[model samples]
Target chain A: MAGYSSPQEFVEHVLEKELSKIEESESDEEILNKLKGLGYID
Target chain B: MSSAAGLLLLALMSAAGLYFDGGSGQHLAYIGPGAGFAFLGSFLTLLWAFAVSAATMLTWPVRMAWKAAKRRRSLKKARVKKLIFVGLDGYDPRTAERLMAEGRLPNLSRLAKEGSYRRLRTTFPSLSPVAWSTFATGVSPARHNIFDFLNRNLKSYLPELSSSRVNKPRRVFKIGRYHIPLSKPSVDLRRKSIPFWKILGQHEVDCTILRIPITFPPEKFNGRLLSAMCTPDLRGTQGSFSFFSTRNESVTYETGSRYPLQRSGNVVKGVLEGPDHPLVPDAGKLGVPFTIYLNGARNSATLEIGGEKYPLRVGEYTPWVPVTFKAGVAVKARGICRFLLNQTEPDVNLYVTPINIDPENPALPISHPSYYSAYLAKLLGAFATVGMAEDTWALNEGAIDEEAFLRQAWMIHEEREKMFFNALDRLREGVAACVFDASDRIQHMFYRYLEGRADGPLADTIEKMYQRMDELVGRVFRYVDEETVLFVLSDHGFGSFRRGINLNTWLLDHGYLALKDGAETAGPYFKGVDWSRTKAYTLGLAGLYLNIAGREAEGIVQPGAEAEAVKAELIEKLSGLKDPATGETAIQRVYATNRLYRGPYLEDAPDLIVGYNDGYRTSWAAAQGIVEREVFTDNPKPWSGDHSVDPVLVPGVLFSNRKIAAEDPGIEDLAPTALELFGLPTPGHMEGKSLFQAAAPA
Candidate 1:
């Protein structure tokens, strides 16, 4: 049986796979950590 | 399957088979009954041709993916040591080119010769905030939701100025990982937008940012940054000691004091006291009094007043000395007193400090703390102790003359420059974008030097300013190595506007609009206009739009009516109407924002637009009537130049010591290119393509 019920869900799943293809996908926590290391405090 | 369905299935099956089989397995094949086998073979041949074509079409994405991956891998192999962004706000290319030909800006000229330069296309309304935001976001105004310098606050329906602090809420927030505790609400780090440096920081690249406009209370990040808030009260010298005593305490503390305090040399050598000076006479000299010791001579007579004994040094430049006093001592005696130095005369005032009730838990001193952060904290704490407005520490200068204004601006610029260089030197993987507002500020203030006709007008001063900017470009290029890419950017270009245009009156005159309350003295577009009957409305930033019901509260234009027709009519009417004096058409081209905004962001845009004729801008004030009879005339007052008109051709300059493809690159491409240079992933949200990947110049 197919895991996804709809085309939109299927498209999203495929897109996520495409995104993960990159070695270092961006994360919010990582971005925030990087900014902090730079000395900009919010 | 039906014949059609069967044919489609056959086509899909063969296409998938050929695509999966690579190249060698693309030959025709037939396995069917006797006579039809020959026919099947013919169909197979056609099917094979179709499959091969499909395979070729499908291979492009794979190739693109491969190339992108290869480029990403190659970029990872090398690293960018430094990245510097130089912003020349409102730098006109025509003036720059003329100066370059004259060989005035040798530094900038050298950079142009060594790197790639192209005329950049500025955004609509062509205002500073709009263009600069576009440069920062690498997206169009519609996408970024910053269409005009002033967007109408929808709920209020009031035309907001770009400079108004009220528009701060709609402003995009840039949040980094660093958290700075502020009295005001901490900045929302969750805003959904990414800046170039933030992206670089994501990949562990550190950046130092100096004086970029619109960033105040700078967000937390991995790099050092001095927030560029170009307010009047910048902390130059926070706290300084002032000696109070009897004598001519002529003190020239510093050249640029926010406020001038009086002092004389006699005060230092005279009676000096601290609040803690002992009450008992002869218990201790309450405070030491000495003659002003400068240039090797005692300035004047001294008197013993408070604790601490110090001998006077006369007529010699002496190092700074502190005079201490015991607690609960009052020496009330008339003596010549000086506080501020350098004045022929000085003012005297009582200096006092409150005693702590509890020695162990003494109230936090409001006086200057030894540390800068501690001083700021104490100052903030004092505000709570005695309810004071946030602006209590604000610096105020009374009525600065033109010369004084220029001096102040220059001083600010110098400090900003230090902050810029400091940040640029430390950046590793990220692009360090720094904007020098001095160029724009100076241009706005002294454009009269170029455009002014009366009293010592400098000829071609605008061109000279451009030359200065070119030199700045040259200075920035020195930081980049062969691998580092550079971009010289501007928010918008500048032009001279003679007169302002008013569109409101034209609508009223044409009977397409109506007043709000049928009152005679109702202001135009001010609460009285019946929007239902109004076919089109023109605001300061947005030209005209049909009042469609669901779309707009008072939309008058019926749904599905030819919007182009109304736009065409408006354009024709606006174009035909010429200024009586100059006879120039004020309306340039009524561009549909959709046609121009092709990148990611496009929601917030004006419906029907009107670009003014070059050298003409809208008025400084809105009450100046919507329709004016005159076409061209000298500008009214205060501001001599305006930006609503078509700005001069402005180009972003890109430089590399290495030979680069002489191809045009979009500003958005900069972020991705930086990522590629550092071997980091360019987020999918980024729309810019790398220039390095573009084919080399012929």
Candidate 2:
């Protein structure tokens, strides 16, 4: 409460943490590269 | 796409993750309630939440006023005060008709008699995720981007989750052999296109969606939503169970792990595995030690783990057991699982259900507003957070029997009912949709009993399940009035899965698909297949894919002429292919996707959708991209019922309180109907028609 300048800021931070974005859509090539780098696939 | 630009973009994403305060990236199901905003103590966090809640209550009037101002004129013109959708995932119309005629499902008969019952056309594949995605978006799989449970990765010739992806954090700090994640992991819902609920919310119409398939990583909307299918367990897999047994033999299952149990007299000990260790890099799966005392005289056992004890009886499931693990410097990851003790006199065998993400303190966002799941957990107690909660794989593996699976399925059903009714009780206006899975799970495991047997322990399970669903509808009717419109629907119907058709094997025999030299059989993921010469192959339940020159990473067939020729060849020969054992045609039809759908993602659809005949489906080995020697095999697994067949033969059922005007309403129409009822025009991208008058409900 002390860190927040206003009540709205505190609420926004809480909701952002709670309902944060879970994923971003990538093209097949990009997804493959990322997965490959993670050693998920050869 | 230069290499330097690609590297820069990746670095920017890592920086963005750090800037975003990313939570639960690849290592999902780790953070728990009271752990977030971790700089503050738990008590301080509670104080913060209370302060926020107090502010919300104090400013409720202002928020409501602002919402009213933002609402469109359609809010006042909405024809219905409430719209309730009851989705029974795999409720077969044929079985429903039989039960209704036999007076076994009286409430369903009442609903049909009062309003109307129609065979709703499902999607081409007739799978839950595909059909339900259509139902939500008012579009086909091409537009919704959900064709099956697994979609093939063109680059690796491997299968990836069709609906979502979890990417690990990019930034990490290392010191003294310990690594600290600077940015949190992320989980992304991959299904493209917007659902009807979001449209309704934009128009200021509230929606409370519960457990709809393909809804994991719940989208932000105007109302509450709890995700369902594709929600991974704490271990970040769909649903992986653990079996601890005293047997010496080692065995493996695609969906679960087996651990050896060491016993001395009455005391038995085993290691229960959890998620990957968060702070330690290169460390394998995390484990927590467990001890069990077998009581042969009493035929019961006492199990202890993580500073808690649970008493387990034979053929009965222990209540959800909390299994906590050390996740970080001070953070602890929590998960819950149920244990079913098999036999003790012979050799102690225990089955622990996949450790579900704790609903109250979930590591992943299973519900929109995130706290909604925690609120429900507090209100209703612990509920299963893992998608596919019934554990059908355990039953199929013989780790648990039919009766045990039924017990677990019913428990989940009851839990869902409580939440659905709670939504109903709280709903003053707008839509409340809840989909129950037991109707699908029980039918999948017990439909074979209906095949040839007259009487058995599980012969009547499907009928009983339908009756229960009917009873659930009866309870839901209590909330309906002239101001409300009610709809009961199934994503797709069910059928027998007796004969497994290995499409890859068929392709191999016809030389459409090829194997490596001296390798007559290919292992899972098509390990022994020679992709250079292979023209076509099948991976997902949807159908077969072609190796086009410009499309696949390793392309052999040219796009314009060669691809079309290969597709035509496969379609001509594979259609009406006969099974040698039963002499019945395995394939009913083969649909070229280009003719079936037109959209931006049409290329994602399998080249050909093989419509299986009744009692035939993709074989167990073939579904995983394995190449078996034979084309047809017996489906020996207990998962004997299926809906992945010709869509026309397995049309889902839709019963409503008002008559629908459309002659053939499909699963996609429901979304357009919801939008129309709320006095909002359906989006131009949607391809479904309004089924009833907007003014009828009132």
Who wins the TM-score comparison?
Answer: 2
Question: Backbone clashes per model, in order?
Answer: 66, 6
- Alpha-carbon lDDT of model 2: 0.79
TM-score of chain B alone in model 1 = 0.59
Interface RMSD of each: 17.7, 13.7
* lDDT (0 to 1) per candidate: 0.43, 0.79
Tens digits of per-residue lDDT for model 1, B87-189? 7666656556666789886766666777655556666657555565555555555544455534343332344322212101122222232111111212221
Model 1 sits at an interface RMSD, in angstroms, of 17.7
Per-residue accuracy of model 2 over A1-42 as CA lDDT, tens digit each:
332323564565457434434323344433332221110111
For candidate 1, the docking band is incorrect
- Give the least accurate 10-residue stretch of model 1 chain B, judged by summed lDDT: B30-39
